[model samples]
Target: MSMNDSWYRASVGDVTQRDALQGDITTDVCIVGAGFTGLSAALELAEAGVRVTVLEAEQVGWGCSGRNGGQINPGLGCDHGRVVAELGADDARKVWQLTLDGVELLRSRVKRHNIDCDLKAGILLVANKARHVPELQSWQHELEALGYDQLAFYDRDALQSLLKADYQAGVMDWGGGDLHPLKYALGLASAAEAAGAQILERSAVLGYEEDGRTVTIRTAAGQVHAQHLLLAGNAYLGKLLPWYRKGFMPIGSYVGATRPLGELATQLIPSRAAVCDMNTLIDYYRLSADNRLLFGGRASARDAQPNALRATMRERMALVFPALAEEDFEYLWGGQVAMTMSKAPVFGRLGRRTLFAQGYSGQGVALAGMAGKLMAQTVQGDAAGFDLMARAKHWPVPPGAPLQTAIRALALLWYRLQDSR
Candidate 1:
């Protein structure tokens, strides 16, 4: 299937297209990118009666926000234990609460806006190997100590009732779930507009110049002068700001959707919970509301989509459920996601008036929106939440593109070796 043939795009109905930037515009806060982060921030700031303008290179939800696995996994990108070790008990508890709040915020927005995205409950983190079972147990204990009580452990036999895979064990998180990502993103944009935010599509930001008082953002056809700016471009930020590029590596991940499986879908996953294995290169899959299996994983450092993506996805799916070997895939797509070395999001400031958030690793579905909300709070004179998130350390990737690519390749190779054992 072509890149444009993603199941999300095929199913997204009646999206309102906004005009591109023309002439100059001014707002209290200017945002770059209209994905989850930008739209979420726009919604928050506009509801607060702040003037906000969002600029997007393409349509809203055109990036990873629309194309991701759609699994709303809880917590930060890394385990909670790592968070506690790095940020102390008190701050870690705050961070943990914020992550849960992110999930709740998503739920509330979907309900408040009457978004038709098929929101569902339950997510299972499964152990791909026997060694991973103990690690999952430790993870569960760590979260329970942090006051999260929504988790339940399942051994191999117990897992068979929900999933017909070879996973050694699993941890079911009742708090996390899945949704129609493109529809969710579009709903955020609509809500932001209703709250008085202006969103301009097809307006790629060329660059920006920041004076001590105001920041001027320039696109091909227009410029936006604002008191503050929020960079929400994530992996798609490209070379717009070379300095930020070093803090995270953009990796391409692929996903495929089979033709509606009808009754077999429920048999594959009886509980309908999204499942992700404990491998470094994880396989995440869940059933679509219409019954198709949306399977994703297989990370690549290359800029282009991997060759024979459908065959590769089918092979991976068959490994977990042999019955799917003959299934016909109707859609295939891939997109880049920013990943930090520490697996925690990278959030910080560019100046007194400029703030940026990105590198959610594999957990951008919910955390990116929360990052935007916190940035909006910071813009409105409440910086405590943003400051706490900025405390998480993000190690820079090697400076040059070639060096970073080499490092990513070596890392993927190491992960493959580890997963094999």
Candidate 2:
């Protein structure tokens, strides 16, 4: 992967060109951060007749929400069985249904609002190690038990027809797909604004003070006084919520997009299905609507933006398909996602009248919408759904602070070692 400025800018076509912030505002809800989560919640709330104001530190989709791998995967980073094992089968079913609704909701929004972000269908979960076969089989059986026929197993022979060499097996899901995430975000923001929601760009929240009834959010341009507040900042929220910091440890993940491969790109991944190779620290990639290979992986907690990530990601992609070792790489952009220790996304109330959701790990494209939707539900006096997820306890990194990085570094080393053998 090459580190060029113009590398793989999503031919996302165009967006509504919404205006920036210029004055103070007051609304029923003040959402801090305009990524998928914030825009999503704003859309739902506004559509429900709730006045909402969204404040983005930068332009919409400028954060991880836009620059992610762009694979619209279903479910949490951890599987449904993990959810049941930790929670219960009943609650897990509700969670699974929401995950399915996430992708469906995205599709409906794209079609209903005419968001042309190159929406494509299908996502393949590939396994490189022989050890991954049983996991895929188990996942297939689990999904089947839940009456979900969306998943199909692929043996090495079947996988050969779709994926390039150096892979063992895979699980293909028909419902979930890939798209230009930035465009989807832009479309959602546009839709939210069109529905009478206030969206302000380049307006960072300086501070917030919450009383028992309402919260006051202070920003650079002005402030937002609202009955409730939603913090959708995710990995960007370093110490905004100190109590939940341990619940979500920000992990830096990098992605690389290749120059258009034309017919060859289509042939390499014949189905054009978004692919994620199974590993504790996995590698996920998909074809940009323009046919560029958008590959992503690796984990780092520190270093907001590493100087050079292209070569690092290139090596990872080359390991799976050496044929692309000589291809002209295009992009080396990376983003951060707040990963929970349990690998399940955390959503619930923080302080009274305040709602928060983060830590989708790498599965935010769909889950973030679900999180935002959940926020709407919570505000409406519906606590059943949110309570199930918020109950999952997140173990804090042992001594906290400086030791967290050292702990994650050790954990990454161990996981990579496990992946090697």
Candidate 3:
């Protein structure tokens, strides 16, 4: 296969296809990158009677959207306390509510569109270290103070009952869940197309020019002139826009799928909750609808696959479920996540008619799709919620790729050290 194959691709049934852009076209809104964010935005815009076009460099969900751990987490990549400290109580509350809105938006879309993506309904945030228990407690308390209380704390005993993992403690959030990400992406694309949106796969955006009135996007096959533009490509945007490159570091995250665990799957996670650890670089895993143990962790500044990727992942799995140490891992893949210095998503206008959202860190499964809806709302002249997210601070990455990589390595090393303690 030309692309890094994923278990998701193997398991999903037939996918919808749209022809590539053949000639120049005009649209009310033009979106680049047809992943969750772009498709979600396109669906909302098309439903509202707007002419929208989505350009994809690869197949829909070919990026991290399809390869993620499939955890539909509620909050941003950072902790709630950190959010309040950085964005302040008022703005932090607004952002928290946006996450809640994101979860609701996902649930509503899945139901309204009748999208069957194996949608599950719970996520367990477990502590990797005993020292992290107090931090988890603080997080639960903070969310409750903000009037959002869907979390149920779990002691070590409770965690062991549900997950045979070496976790210290955990909190289960009924508000969060997991799903088949690629199926969800395809479902959104289908819904968008059904609403009259045009999606052109294999149509990579070359560049664009916005003359205040309208933006003209040039691609290999065609050009698109639109009154507004949405750059939803995230880490895959590359150098298509120079300024955007400075806002986020594209880091590689790895995931693996095991052979079906059969009855052992239910025994491991009896409640069938998606689970993640609390370290800066954490381990996340869930049982697939087919009973495979899909586990993900490990990160790299470069795109190079880790030496012995499957072996390392299997070792990690053994730590969680020693009974499954011999379980055969059938799939190993990695994808880039756009991580910002602030660990908050970067959202704002490029000039006047151009808008973009990226740096979802590693929590893009739900938030990215919701951001697309927020982008659609912004295009419709409603920018309240979008602006709230755009208000979060972002620093430009240093000019050189080598320097940026080194800085990220140093920063991640420090985080790893902290996690070790």
**Highest lDDT model number:** 1
Q: Write the per-residue lDDT of candidate 2 for residues 160-214, one digit (tens) a residue.
A: 7877756889888988888888878888998998898988887878889988888
Computed on alpha carbons, the lDDT of every model, listed in order, comes to 0.90, 0.80, 0.86
Q: Estimate TM-scores for all models.
A: 0.98, 0.94, 0.96
Q: Write the per-residue lDDT of candidate 3 for residues 301-323, one digit (tens) a residue.
A: 77866445677778888888899
Cα lDDT tens digits for candidate 1, 1-421: 2336688998975678799999998899999999999999999999999999999998899998989999997798887778889999899889889888899999999999999999999999999998999999999998888778899999999999989888999999999999999999999999999999999999999999888989999999989999999999998987665553347898889988989999999998999999999999999999999999999999987765544576778899999989989986788888988988889998888878889989999898899999999999999999998999999886766667798788889989998999999
Please give the ranking of all candidate structures by TM-score, highest first, separated by commas. 1, 3, 2
Which of 2 and 3 is ahead in lDDT?
A: 3
Name the candidate that leads on TM-score: 1
> Residue 283's C-alpha lDDT in candidate 1?
96
